[model samples]
Target: MNIFSRRARLGNAWAVNVRLRIAQGKIATIASAAEPQAGDVVVDTLLPALANLHSHSFQRAMAGMTEYRAQDRESFWTWRTLMYRFLDHLSPDHIAAIAALTFMEMQKAGYAAVGEFHYVHHQPGGQAYDNPAELSLQIIQAAALTGIGLTHLPVLYTYGGLQAQPLAGGQLRFGNSVDAFCDIVSLSEKAMAALPADTCIGIAPHSLRATSESDLRQALDLHAGMPVHMHIAEQTKEVEEVAAMRGARPVEWVLGQCEVNEQWCLIHATHMTESETAALAKSGAVAGLCPITEANLGDGIFNGASYVAHGGTFGIGSDS
Candidate 1:
């Protein structure tokens, strides 16, 4: 396939009357100072599509429902309580429908791919479905339907809090032993075989507060070199809880414990200190920022200026 654009942004500059050749679902070649051909798809403006690096597709169904204030002092925790209640009623069919719509909207908005940070795994009562990857297959099917490149992240959520508390309420659906999570990843890999080659699987260790050091290590070891994503310092309460239990802030502790690099993406690293920001900038890991969701949840602003000044890499996500 060939595409001729009157104005197209190629790298850092714009070219007039450029032609791009698509071969095997990828751009094979680009030619500038070209004329319109007889059989070419023409467009006025063309730019590279983006990848939404973090998202929870199931939450897209509860979009406008959570905007109402249920309390005088509304916060992320309070909004989370309502989200838990809302998710209890979603079946696998509902998950597929919601995910399909979310992926379609992402494509319409110029996103060619998404990294779904999926966590809702089991039935509402904490019981496993006949297949461990039931919900995961739904996400895979949705991505297939929308033709979106998917990096499905099966999150390992073991506990409820930083101190290894038992799972409760909606957290029950997300809870899984390290062994069970491995099974889910294995089954999900099998299900993704029907999708395009670019559709792949990754692992997420929900967050510092939700997993122990031992559990996190086990989850990391499950996927040898795949993309690793984790929720870091998103909320102040979470930061305090992790610091109290682990004796260091979330970013500082993870940096000390892990060999973070380009393959890792730390989501919502919104509450970092000067040293933590500098260290993360130098670590070669992508800072996954979800500005819209961060603002909605009242999560603090990321240190973008300072991080960029230090030559950091970052990506944007919807995260809903």
Candidate 2:
């Protein structure tokens, strides 16, 4: 059973004295102008919850540690070096602990669900664990422990740069061939079977620079038309790189190459031309915005006013 009040911003605008009868863990009925009776539970206030559309749960462990200004010109690239170092030492146990605490914090912050864009798949030396989904299972367990909805988006990261460079240094952990990535996806789906029914699985091609055109096609074909996400135009360098490598802008190349509809979410689409912005808005894909992280990373502001004017869809996340 549940109840809501307009005074607490918890109920529909038209609802008064709202009550919900839950059955089988689902709301069976909603009634307004209802009165509490024998054995009824009540709260003075309640609030609606939101979904965190993008997250790197393990990075929650290194939150305040990366703020130090070690270099004269620190940017996203430099911040990533610290991130790589932090993840280099994480065992499955560490991942679980960090994820559990982070998920608990998200729950406390009123996030009912989280879309984890998980990429740490291999051991420190880039060796696959006996279970390919070892880190993924840890994330799932964390979500299960906290009762937070999980939308697991396993990231496919293959190349080092726009020129299809080989994975170098710390990136080895995130590299997987098409066949190996498919195996991991299959294993992740099986691992989630014992999880809550609301748990979902999605694919994330790490970014235009990390994936080739053929690789993107393979990822999408393997996805079977589920929710697809990609990191696009997060940095100006990335936009320039895609243009130099692909002869078109990142969003432009994607819109021409893929069937981007409501099932697609372009994360960190911070840099775009007016035409690209309008085209993306007309494409019906969501712009997954991480406002806090964008600010922290010095990523530019999104064209929110224009995008919203064109009926673009978007969702919020704390992209750690």
Best by lDDT: 1
Report the Cα lDDT for residue 123, model 1. Answer: 99
User: How many residue pairs collide in each prediction?
Assistant: 0, 0
List candidate 2 segments past 4 Å from native.
7-16, 22-28, 33-47
- What candidate 1 gets wrong by more than 4 Å, as runs, is 6-17, 22-29, 39-45
Write model 1 residue lDDT over 1-320, tens digit each, in one string: 99999999989999999999999977899999999898999999998899999999999998988776777889898888989999999999999999999999999999999999999999998999999889999999999999999999999999988779999999999999999999999999899988877788999999998888998898887688989999999999989988888899999999999989999999999999999999999999999999998998889999999999998999999998
Model 2 lDDT on a 0 to 1 scale: 0.87
Give me candidate 2's TM-score against the actual structure.
0.92
Every model's TM-score: 0.93, 0.92
